[model samples]
Target: MVAVIKSSASIKNVLQYNENKLKQNVAQLIHSGNYGKDTEQLGFTDKIRTLEKLISLNERTKLNAVHISLNFDPSEKLDKETLQKIADTYMRSIGFGNQPYLVYQHHDAGHPHLHVVTTNIQRDGKRIKMQNIGRNQSEKARKEIEKEFKLVQAEAHHLKQAYEIKPVNIQKVQYGKSDTRRAITNVLDVILPTYKYASLPELNAVLKQYNIVADRGKEGSQLYNSKGLMYRILNDKGEKIGIPIKASQIYNKPTLKFLQQKFLQNQTEKQRHKLRIKNAIDFSFVKRPEQSLQELINALQKERIQLVLRQNDKGIIYGLTYIDHQTKCVFNGSDLGKPYSANQIQERCNQQMQRHEQKLTQRPAFKHANEQKQSALTTAEENGITFKIPGVKEVFKELIQTEQEGSLAAELRNDELRRKRRKKLHH
Candidate 1:
């Protein structure tokens, strides 16, 4: 199964663009929370549109929107089109079309999945209740979809059981392996219902609170109480779900602390990477080669691109152009600070333009434009507009004369009617 979540606030715009077909196939209202009577009475279209609008609003206010869609795997006999039809029918069963919602099948990404777009708002213009409603509804919907599709309940068996493993140490213990395992086991069984510990330390704390001691082996003066040892935690089904392992195994094998530190470090690296991307677009101090703002905008527009300006800590403006969805190239905006020499500015502009043109050539649009031009020429000839051939000239001339006569006749009738009106008034 695959899942997708999206939230949007542009219900009207999205529906109107698609001709409102989304609101027509809704089967039923599964659940509505917090909006009271107004939401309860909303039809499928209104409900969907309202929710979509709310999602958009939520994105604007919270800088995030959440949507989730899931589908079952198809059997061997079913092809892609069959799988999509099944997904669509399942969506309809869940009231997808009756409300203002969008459901899309994405088969490009390995597995077949559905993309559901919904609003976070109700008919009364209030935000959906956030009391874990999303999680709860998703779980409920998943089960129903699975049941409706008659999908096999894929097994949750653990491959770790195939190996005979021994506990390293009971003392110098972090959380007792057995109890930590049981706690995790219970969590997986859905007994706890809230398992938010994404890190080893947090998991360690939970195990400790449950009176579970976690211990690791020691070597010389070094205690092997690293984060790698925290992998013993199991859910009620005895599945190794919330386990953390270290990258290094033989040489200086990972401990629980090392694993935790690595996870945190990796998270920090990811954050830094995202920040760098954002800064490239918004930082002011990043120097652009030396083009004026107008010149930069013109260059980007010529290349079918958009420029994003960012202010840096030094109060300098930096301009970065988004070349595509996944790539951005930076330019120097320092010319905004002081008057630049004509030679320096001209050289910078030329360099920037060269880079931008080179980037554009690498884009899909370059090839797509060529194909489109070729197709347009073919179409023109098929319609007799490309009549450079000797034999087709007579046919083209006759067609043009017919068109001109039709136009002249329409004009003459208008003029004669106007003259008749003028003479009637005089009489």
Candidate 2:
């Protein structure tokens, strides 16, 4: 079992997240603690009002909402009773036993997980201390609960491939419809926090998978200068079709300023994942050498890493971005190191092209030489002439040298040019 906890300033957003899922029939309210009525017995306003009352106890506490998820291994087939018990045990162990909280069982993914929503503000108008709650208290509680329930230990189990949320069907999100906005929100909510994307375009790559894209109008537009960003739903053909929603207006506040902050934070946070990504790229090349840029993209896709190659208007490749879903990190190729940088990758691709061309150039020459030799032998047999089959060892050596000289020289010149380019890139 694993626990993911985050504190939110708004309780309504967290509650609405689960409530929307419940409306979709993908989640069910399992246990309602401190609330006099169960979720189904109360309306939406009542649910929010009840949680709001608890949050209102401490007006000074800005970050009052605590949203957490307890994720179990897919191998564990836990029923509702077992899940509820785990939630209750986890809450009480983390010093929230007496707090007002609600547990919802979410079956949206392959694994069984529960989303728990509560307020840090207690009934006594005092805020609960949440500093290092996950690292210090929650980790201890997780281990104990796993041992107590004989649950599958997270350390002992290797999680299966990640399950990404399915893209929304384009036909369902008609223009000027609420479903379009809701569909876009559902995708963004799941993707924005989960995936590690550094820039707006990198984030859009993942968003495009869900028929959504982020736009900044045009290059010199007023919106672009202000760093304003908007999310638009796309059709099946990837053309924009719906009304664009400003980034600031979104529930999660995925504004340009917000994303820019995350970009800087990710720079430091993603260092630990550098080696893992490097090894994955190395393994990819070992499995399939001489891969073009497109082929490399295809290979990395199988590893659940998106390779975004940036090119100039002249079609020269200049930048590379690696988005690793497994580690949930984003890295520029150069950020990882020089070997993984854009220029180095282009050099590798050039080497592939050279090797392939060399092979193509050699095959025909060898085939033609063999054909000449066969013709000579046939003539000697048919004419009844006594002709010695001369050993052309020295001749063949000279032929190979002559045939390879130009290709080898070209390869040498290319390597020299690449070295110069790398030097410039470093400068």
Candidate 3:
């Protein structure tokens, strides 16, 4: 079992966050410790008020709320009772036994995890010093509890998922270059040799989360030809800051040579993840058939795959890369298939645009035809023509009027002929 903890100043926010999961139906309140009632007896609002009242005792500490999540192995299928016991024991072992903490079982992720919401402040208003609490207290408790509970021992491979990287504020790092270097180093130390990436852009997509970039000079430049690379801290805008640090200067020596070897190895190692990347891409298009390139990128990002577009100097996209962060696999778009290639994707985007534009243009023609039909019906009513006959009533009315006029002209000719004969006889 792995324990992850985060501290916040707002008790309401942490309580609402866990309760929101309950609203989503992906979580359940399993155990309420040090509370008057059982988990089933207490309502969500009551739970929040209970924790808040405890935090109110210590008005001096701004960061009083403690949010901790304990993740078990995906292979472990512990029942609610077993999970509750483990949560209670872990809390007591970590010295939060007396504090009022709400235990919630979250089912959103693949593993069985529980979220504990409690405050560091005691009922007597004394603050629990949380300095090194995670390293000193939580780590020791996690090991002992893992053994006692017979849970899967969290291997090194599971460490990254257990403890996520904390993001550094880019704006703050600008004040000191060493802080930027140290921050970059901290991230690279974990990601450089671990995550399988084939190219620089794929690596950047992963580094982007930590506000760091591994940059090679412009194409055909001395640095690019020499296969030299440098690392730089990226600001909020994604622009580089401070002098670029050479890869060789870093203790790990993440040079181009080192990265190239990783690229070659990743080519073979990342094959296992190709199906997952393909499925994610296919699923995105199925969900939103008319999605633009940017929309597709957003959708894939939710699936834990970062799609990076490679463009030329003229701003024409020539290639595509997908960084599957979940599997730590990097694949070139062409490597996936011709369908995932840049040209093919651009074609799909164009087809979607054309379909949308065609619909927009066809709307006016359809509206005009409907309007003309309505106008014809209104004119027929104004001219005393009934349209109930349905078989071209206007044409039938014109034919009837022509026949009646011909018969009347013939009758008037006959009367004129009679009048002429009578005048001749009188003369």
The candidate that achieves the highest lDDT relative to the unseen native structure: 3
lDDT of 2 at 400: 54
What total of clashing residue pairs does each candidate reach? Answer: 59, 0, 0
Highest-TM-score candidate: 2
| TM-score against native, each model | 0.26, 0.61, 0.48
Q: What is the full ranking by TM-score, best candidate first?
A: 2, 3, 1
Candidate 3's TM-score: 0.48
* lDDT digits (tens) for residues 1-427 of candidate 2: 8887776667887888898889999998888777777646876777778779978778877668888889888878988888888988999999999877889899787788999999888888888898668778899999999999888776663642233356877766673435666677668766765666677776776788688998988999999998899888888867898678887766656678767866665567668888888887888778877788788888888888888777777878788888887877777788789989999987887788789777755765445655555565567568875434465644644565565565556666777899999999999
Candidate 1: tens digits of C-alpha lDDT, residues 1-427: 4333333223443334223323444222333333324534655566454555555544433312334445444432445455555555544544443334444443432334454545544444555543344346544555665566655433323312221123323332344443333333322222111222224433333343333323443444234633234334334332333333332321222245444543453333333223333343223213454455556555544444444443457845443323211222221223222222233434556776687768755555454554555565567678878667787857755665565556555665777899999999999
By lDDT rank, best first, the candidates go: 3, 2, 1
lDDT per residue as tens, model 3, 114-232:
99999999888898887668778999988888889887876557754655675556767766635665577658756865578887777887788788889998999999988899998
Q: How many angstroms is residue 57 displaced in model 1 relative to the true structure, after the best TM-score fit?
A: 6.9
lDDT of each: 0.41, 0.78, 0.79
